[model samples]
Target: MQSSIIIADDHPLILKGLNDFLLEKKYNVLASAVNGKDALELIETHKPEIAILDIQMPYYTGLEIAEKCKALNYQTKIVLITFEKDEAIYKQAKSLGVYGYVLKEFALTEIEQCIDTVSKDIPYFSPELLSYLEVESTPKELETLTPTEKEVLKHIAQNKTAKEIGDLMFISNRTVEKHKSHIIKKLNLAPIQNSLLIWAKENQTLLE
Candidate 1:
């Protein structure tokens, strides 16, 4: 059976491209919208079997739209397509009950596979993201972190810079750097700053 779908994106080219791509794949495009608000209205009216959403949109975010869909009990499976592959975004998408996530840089074949997989009530994620998840799921020792180290991690997740974290925690810049190094070693995470930030954000909910 052909899956009925609605796509929501702010870009005209993307909206049209997606519609064309899905049409070629034999899926029915019930509607397309430029923002989350319109997407919600279309879903409520049309109730397509799936919704393909872009994360960064004006007015309301894709996550916000997904929440609304779930609340209304719309039955449409949501697939979030975005450029961001950050762990925090992935975690949020999971929490929102998204059926699939396709990175924008991946081939159209990947997107098609995701749509087909999710239409069958299964979840899908890009292979690169799957690898990241495998690394993140490994057990780590919390006892290795001092209280100050954990505090620094929490502040980092809240989008604080190293200097900001030092000021807020009433520690010296050197102390903050030492704590960050300890955190990286304990977590077995990559040495990059962005990777650390993503890890911190992804794990923040659990820390709370």
Candidate 2:
């Protein structure tokens, strides 16, 4: 049987583009929705095998729908698409147990593979999203940190523990650890004990 899919996005162009693409690729597009409420209705009515959802939508966000689906034990796999490059939102999406997290910029090339992977009950996150989590270094590295990265990195450099960072951020200690790991990797710091704190000290200007 051809795999069935439900797609929803607020932008008409984006919603149409994805729907057309999936149809061109021969998947059974059960329905397309312009908002989260309608999307939920279609899911409950059609029970599609996969749901390609936009992270931002009227009535309910994709993450919210995914959580509801999980609560109801629905069989649909969720793949969230978004244009925002945000670490916190990505963490939230992962926490919701979404089947995929795809950036709109990479959607055309990657969505096909994402749907395929999700069909197998595996998760897929865009490479661009993963790249942001990787360690990169330049002479002016501190100048390149995002606001969130700078905040977390600053705390680490200040000799704050993961628990302390989590308390400050109102996030879990595990989340703090994840951020710390990403900071170390992104700064391209040598994998040695206390390397991050040392680098943090060396680059105080960037954090401050």
Candidate models: Cα lDDT each = 0.81, 0.84
Tens-place lDDT digits, model 2, residues 61-163: 9989999999999999889999977877877887777889999999999998988877876678887776664334334555566778789988887889889
| TM-score of predicted structure 1 | 0.64
Sliding window of 10 residues with minimal summed lDDT for model 1? 134-143
Count backbone overlaps in model 2. 3
Q: What is the lDDT of residue 109 in candidate 1?
A: 65
Instruction: Estimate the TM-score for candidate 2.
Output: 0.64
What is the lDDT for 25 in model 2? Answer: 90
Residue 146 C-alpha lDDT in model 2: 70
Best by the lDDT measure: 2
